[model samples]
Target: MMLPLILLYLIGYETRVTTACSRLEACNSEFRTGLEVAGIQEPESSAPYCAELRAYSQCIKKANKACRGDLSFHTSTAVIDSLMKRFKCAQQNWGPPYKRPSVKPKSNSICSHQSNSEYVHCGIFGDPHLKTFTKSYQTCGAKGAWPLIDNKFLAIQVTNMPVINSSSATATTKVTIIIRRVPGCAEEKTFEATSDAPLRPFFVDSSYSTGPEGSVQMKASINKTEKVEIYLRYIDTTLVVRRVGEYLGFSCRLPWDIAKIREENALELCQTGCPGTELLDIASSRGHRLSWETALNKCKQDMDLETGVRNNLTDQYLDWCVFDVMTTGKNEFVSTAHLAQEDVLYMDPSSLRNRTFPLDLNGIPKPSSAAISNVTLNLQVTAVVDRCGRNVVHAPAYEGAPQVGRVAIKVPPIWENRIPVL
Candidate 1:
């Protein structure tokens, strides 16, 4: 009874809440009065209510009057609407609530490439030598870690860049300078001002030229994050090319590899927790009514047959092959029946168009026709377990890789369930 009433209240009451001020004539008159109260020229009657309200809020804020919620009956609808409109507008802009200031490049200074740049032109280590080729600016660099010299600021001209890091017959004017470690070269220490002269073209991050003899510190240097500190310079008017000390290296591990480790760990934990619970479950299900060993063989036959049936979904024989690593017991019943349902979603229907699963009956107990039946158990079990794990976390999926006609499947080690289900 209470549930029905609660549902009725929830569905019916909230939709009917009316605005505090809904009288249209009163609203219009208040709108006119609000302009006078705000000391603003009257807007055309066609102006939106929100616009009028916005102007009112601006007027009140400028006049330093209390805004909303502090009102007695004297709070006119026009005034209230004005405050409400401004509040709604400010909400979208993330203001009044305050927003983080956006970092911008200096007006006078220009950075060629802004992709790697964070806030300022030199904020993050960026190659400032972005240049125009065929009338557009694009990132330019070598295959390895090397600074790209901006052709626009070059004093000399070169036809084409080459592999060698040294200058050749196609070389331009050479600008050489000495290199030395500043006394306190910690990651956090800022570089000292270069000279008292004006700067022309900016330099790349982590590289700088030394100031004249008595200067306190080196001129310009970029921290690891690539922030630029501009200062006075001296005879440094000439462009001096200094080597950037070291290159930072980065590497990544595939998520599938990580999943494998996690899965292996989970398996170990499960083994410890259950202590042979798998065999126990099999034994309890197929009791003394049938020899435990015979039941196990029957289970294995079922699994193998199921696996073959699933193999029809894919032409790859290797994909259907059940590996020992995926199973704890040899010759034990394998269930892949559950996998058939998942195949509707996972397996490509196209793979089955021209594929067949060969049945071999040599020393095996089941006949050729019965072999498919034998494979069924393993397939069902594998499919069920695979689907359950798939539900836990969706795999990092990739679509057709080699081409549209082909697909590649990569599941995490944990997702593999150490069980095969293709």
Candidate 2:
């Protein structure tokens, strides 16, 4: 009887082990299928690919759990570690698409090429050496002809720009410039400073209606290192307004260096605790309102201290750190009331565009314009970190790229009498 019982027990144990092994193999097969569906035939660093790989990792984890009691079944730690490394690689390569800043017209004048030609070449009036052509113009000598001439023209030249103060934290610089026009072209000249510069108005040629009436004046200021762009405006001979350059500016490296330092600092903070944690705690105890930007900066500083490097933090790593901090603590908040109010007032088609007589749940006619006032109520506001970190709000869909993560934060409302109904 004892011999028979041992044989039965051994047989049962073997069957169980075989089943567990089969399940593990099935999990691996499913993971491979997921990779194929995700187009991850070869290891490539991309957010979508990494996300798919993570799904495979999850499958492996589930299989490991399912086979927990089986002595012969186990998840491969080496494979998991490899997948994690690949995920990190993918994240490091992902970010929002780059976009160029739009140019805002400084004057009321509108400028266009004089002819319908494919190419228009423009030259400064005074300087024989200065000439530039538009890239979008038709081919030269096609129909409109080359060397498009304007009676009135404006030119911008950067004489000297130097980085006076340079630091890893910030850089200060000065720009000196000059504007000149063709002799007897326009009756006046107006010089417009770049966005970052101090606005100084210097007008020349009072006779020209298209240009600002006055003379050229040079203005300089200490500023965060940035590109120095100057714009020139004047009226052409036909009394048509024309602008010569869009962001015709000088570039430097100081600003970029400072940005790199800040990024590195932010990454270090995410990896480790922010410096002076006790001080931060005390401040929180005293009801200090910590701004999101400030908190982000603090994290950057901590990162810089740890790595002693600049610009080593990628956008993905920073985003992950932000999400982690936001979800783990009450460091942020979103005003649920404001969002709800906005949805009712702006998003609802009936409320915003088409008005209809609708009855409220209380059997009262709903007002054309909804109002919420003079009522003290306890409302729950969600934490901003939680919303952004966990992706509760889906990111806008992109056509060709992975869905990028985003954080939408609402500003706290201040008390004001008679808030306008949106």
Candidate 3:
């Protein structure tokens, strides 16, 4: 999938941040608890954001220093103030105020009074510059440069959470979470989704509720990375609260080379190493040039170290050499009995005429035999892009090194009885 241009911004961020975990104990606790609330572990042991946070924090620190260190503090605070102005408090009145009967009580303001049943806290965080945070004037419609967020880990808590579905046996509240200090546009980007449904407009209390319910306090710190932490709370009884959570760990950027390494590892694990020496040599020689070669070689190397796995590399350049000889009977120097086997063997008259034959009882007869004059070996090779897929070459022409004449035989004529079959 084509991820948004935000990926580019993350690449830059990765270099600047160093230590994302300002407090080891606190970060670990948050991670453990968050995982418990999430119910499942993060993918590939990447849960809790401890590792990513550390890296992001260090990167941000570096970037901050380069941007003038303490010089930018006042500016950042100004930016934060501007951004926070968007969120306005909604009004609410729990009950009538207690009063001594001495003096007349004053009426409550609209910010404090509300009838029951209406969602009292419904309010919008407004900013004319909100959308501009993620975009630049140069790139219209394209998500512009992503700004660096303060690496602070802020603890967020939502308690007395609102009930989105008082009727349903199980219902989730949804809240729209906009990343604070995000640059350019506020084009909504979701973290990880539980199912196929997009999680955004994210929920604060429930997965669907719009407002912050109850007192949910999440511990956050400065210089920490941003990861999606979803806390699910349930009540076995009203007094006892239980939580399960699922979190998505986001790296400032995608680990492209790391992914390639994983693929290589998996391939080696699956195939028990590659098929041939030629392929191994080619991979070793050219691995630096292509991701495919590097990945294949790394996998082969790992598989070689693993027990019960043998290197039989065949999909590499060396395999091309091995298979070429096996198919054409041109390179008689290679041992074929153990490497390449076929139900049948075909030979071209020209090849059979001049080639030195291996003196096996099962191999082709010597060139001096009477039958050699009428003998013709029909060899064919097919090109295919994938295993289990149709052959790409119906009747491919065989090309040898310049010193050797290339051979191309038309399909029907090569197979016909009139072509002087061997």
TM-score per candidate, in order? 0.14, 0.18, 0.14
Error of 2 at 73 (Å): 61
Task: Please state every model's RMSD to the true fold in angstroms.
Answer: 27.5, 29.8, 30.5
- Report the lDDT tens digits of candidate 1 across residue range 1-422: 11111211111111111123223223334444544444444222223433555543444343333324422112333335444543464343322321122223233332111121111000001111111110111111222222222111111111112212321101111121222233322111122212122222344344333343322123322321111222211111112121111111100111111112222223221011111221111111111233334333344342244223222222222112121101222221122211221121121222222222221111123213243233321111111123444422211112211112322233333323433332
Query: What lDDT is reached at residue 397 by model 2?
Result: 24
When summed lDDT is taken over every stretch of 10 residues in candidate 2, the lowest stretch is 135-144
Q: How many residue pairs collide in each prediction?
A: 43, 16, 78
Per-residue lDDT value at 268 in model 3: 19
Off by over 4 Å in 2: 1-112, 115-154, 158-179, 187-198, 204-422
Model 1, which residues run further than 4 Å from truth?
A: 1-201, 204-225, 228-388, 391-422
**Predicted structure with the largest lDDT when compared to the true one:** 2
How much RMSD separates candidate 1 from the native structure?
Answer: 27.5
Clashes in candidate 3: how many? Answer: 78
For candidate 2, write residues 1-422 as lDDT tens digits. 11111211111111111123446555445544555555554555676556544554555566676767653333233444455573575445434422222222234433321221121122211000111221110001011111122111322222212111121111011122223344432333444333244434333332223323322222232222111122222221111111112111221111111112222223111111112211111111111133334434443332233222222222212322222223222221111111111112211111122111111112222221112111111111111223233312112222222122333333223212112222
lDDT of 3 by residue, 1-422 (tens): 11111121221211111123223223223333433444433322222223333332333344453443332232333322332222210122212222112221124422122221101000100000010111100001111112111111111111111111221111111222232221221122222223113333233323321112321212221112122332211100000011112111111111112111222223210011111220111111211122333333333331222221222322211233232222222221021111111000010011112111111112222332222122212111222222433222222122211112333333332223322111
